[model samples]
Target: MSARSVEVRLVKSGRTKIRYGAELLADDGVRLTVRAPWAGEGGRDFGFVRFEPGDVFTEHYWRDRWYSVKEVRTGDGMLKGWYCDVNRPVAFSGGELTAEDLDLDLWVSHDGATVLRLDEDEFAASGLAERDPEAAEQAVQALDELELMARLGKLTDLLA
Candidate 1:
């Protein structure tokens, strides 16, 4: 049979609403390989730094975890860095794949140095712990593991 592919959507969960962030494509099933679209905001400003809109990312996901590692690149194919999201593993159904971004993130620069941890405050304010304690704990654990991996320069291996 031919390989299966499904549309991927990243949803930002809010107190009373869900915001659609980006739409992409992913290989079907539990372990998904997603190709996320370039940022339409012309790049995202992380406060400390910014990524150009031309930057594209490829994400790797496992169904039983809390994070996904995304390899970021420039429009000209230059490797920018690796941006990882601490989120729910992923769920696929009805021809669409979805993931809940848990707010915490780890960014490892292309050279493997300059790792930046982002959005902890937002995560704390998210009330996720109160809503789903288990998932919140899992998300924190995932962030810790990702930070360790990025520090050890092992994140690049995920892309392969």
Candidate 2:
């Protein structure tokens, strides 16, 4: 409604497992912005990077099938690059909202130049194709669309 505090969960598809959680900062029904502590954990090995526990992230989530974009910033408000997760449409229920991280990701640089795609191999190895081919195909399409948006620099407005 009016940017009330809510719990946001990133849950695995068709399961009760929660991969991540954050505090919802704003919600206009169609889109939600959330803030959470930045844990320097990702699928890839990018060496050592320093992020304080209270380093805030403002993540934007759409009700549609677009990927969620997280604008990372330091605790003192320094800019960090965006980390986006390609996933299915978000679902909100009760006091919580959830999204399925499709295992495909796109990282856009702070200046929005260097867009890197991540976790294709992990997506392929996730057995989603064997479990649910149609959903897996949709995930691929979502990834393609998000990649194009990142390349065209259309994702910057999403954070604002």
Candidate 3:
């Protein structure tokens, strides 16, 4: 099938955090994959990694899963790492894909030597536990699952 353009919206607290265009790569009822270039204004340096203009991201989202995984690569196609987001299940409609950020994330270095869990403080302060305990639990579980996958060298399995 021919690839189609799609707009991806990452939402936080009922607001759109980021929206960018991507090329739809595949969809199998439950999951959707898209490839997009770095959408940031300039470059973001996180000490562990840097996201610049030529970076490319192949992102995977699931309708039933509580997280999304993105494979990050350099302009020359060298793998940088995997960035995983703990989010609500994704929805695709009207040529847009939307997912709500749950404030938890995991990052695995390309060589699998570095695994970091991020945004725990933000999640704890988000009041999600008080507002929706079930979702908060699921989000924590999802982050744990992703970390395990990264440690076991099985993170790529999700892409397949």
Candidate 4:
């Protein structure tokens, strides 16, 4: 293997088993490597990516973030995740992100989702204006972490 490449091992047998090298098929029928950089190395916390039932996974992180997609009772669909990479924006092909230009701005096309960046002032002035000051006020406070993520670049791209 190359210096940056690692071999993935198929621990369990199911639909996502592999007969070849370390590569294996995932429950979603997508082939993924168990050897992500986050999987620990040499007994140290290099990094680890482990997948399990219901489309869930336990992935360790290094310099980057981790995410997964799962299909449960309703059938496995893509899952989203975000960690320490808060400084950067996100994108998604599941939402068909945006235009494809020659620029380095590749946040779009990430799951084909369009995202609007909201400044702090804009967010303060934004939201529905209603007569019920309490309700409006509550709405503003209700803007939890998820809502804040929407205001960033493109968050939809972190799909499983």
Candidate 5:
């Protein structure tokens, strides 16, 4: 199929957190891949990593998976790292893809030496455990699985 523009909407607590346009790269029944530019304004420096303009994101989302993996790269095609988000399985309809963020994330650095689990405090504060224990547990499991893959230098397998 020819490339098409798609909007990616990230939802949290029944609200849209962020939305951006991307180019649909591929779709294989269960998985969808898209290419997008960094959606944040200016740059964000988290001490351990920085996301800026000119960065590219090759994002993969699965219909049967609890998480999405994004390969981040510099403008010149240099590898930066992978950013994984624990979320509900993605849904695509009306030319848009939507995912409900679970407030949990994993960041794997370029060399796979710095794997960080992020937003645990937020996840705890979100009260997901009280509201939906099963989803909360699945989110945690997804984060753990991503971390293990990063440490084992197998994170790319998901992208493949």
Candidate 6:
């Protein structure tokens, strides 16, 4: 099986002069969208990555997040899987989570779109609020993967 990589960078951090953001570097040099916090980190800093989810949650403030590789499954078969997440030490809802809160869950989709599944009911009726919000976005800029591949002299060879 073929594979790819997702490396998380401290685009945005508590220790940086500029506001924090996360960079998703695909194994193929595809960079996903770099986004700033709708809010911002309260005290967290540092970052880490894990292949599979585990009980290893960080209690201390971290400056970075973790990246996990995911397969890019296609109906035809599969291309490859490479993805990451900024919720390593899983971040909690930064503030009070309520139905009004715009919560987002990040996941890589087959169509190359960064999938954000919003849980309105959870935010509205549950205590999943008043916590740090996780940094969410697609592993790479969806529209740019192909463009980037071409620039690197790759795309054409990726045919099924």
Q: For each candidate, what is the lDDT? A: 0.75, 0.75, 0.96, 0.26, 0.94, 0.27
TM-score order, best first, reads 3, 5, 1, 2, 6, 4
Summing lDDT over every window of 10 consecutive residues in candidate 6, give the lowest-scoring window: 53-62
Q: Write the per-residue lDDT of candidate 2 for residues 67-100, one digit (tens) a residue.
A: 7888877778887677888777888877677888
Q: Which lDDT tens digits does candidate 4 get at residues 1-160? A: 4333334322211232222222122222222322222322233221322233333322211112121211111114443222211111112223111111111111112232433222335334533243345634433443333344444643433333
Write out the backbone clash pairs for model 2.
Answer: none
The C-alpha RMSD of each candidate to the native structure, in angstroms, is 3.5, 3.4, 1.6, 17.7, 1.5, 15.5
Identify the runs in model 1 with alpha carbons over 4 angstroms from their true place.
1-5, 14-29, 47-49
TM-score of each: 0.82, 0.81, 0.98, 0.18, 0.97, 0.24
**Model 1 C-alpha lDDT versus the unseen true structure:** 0.75
Considering TM-score, which of the candidate structures 2 and 4 is the better prediction for this target? 2
Candidate 6: stretches off by over 4 Å? 1-63, 66-69, 72-77, 80-86, 90-104, 123-126, 131-160
For model 5, residues 16-38, the per-residue Cα lDDT tens digits are 99999999999898999999999
Q: How displaced is residue 118 in candidate 6, in Å? A: 3.5
Which candidate has the highest lDDT of all?
A: 3
Tell me the tens digit of each residue's lDDT in model 6 across 9-103: 22222332232222222212221222112122342322221222111111111112233223332233443222322223222223211011122
Candidate 4 all-Cα RMSD: 17.7
State the displacement of the C-alpha of residue 38, model 6, in Å, after optimal TM-score superposition. Answer: 32
Residue 143 lDDT, candidate 3, scale 0-100: 97
The 10 consecutive residues of candidate 1 with the worst lDDT sum are 14-23
Which of the predicted structures, 3 or 4, would earn the higher TM-score when compared with the native? 3
lDDT of 1 by residue, 7-92 (tens): 55777783322322333445445667766556445666776446776676677877887898888887788887888888787887
- The TM-score leader among the candidates is 3
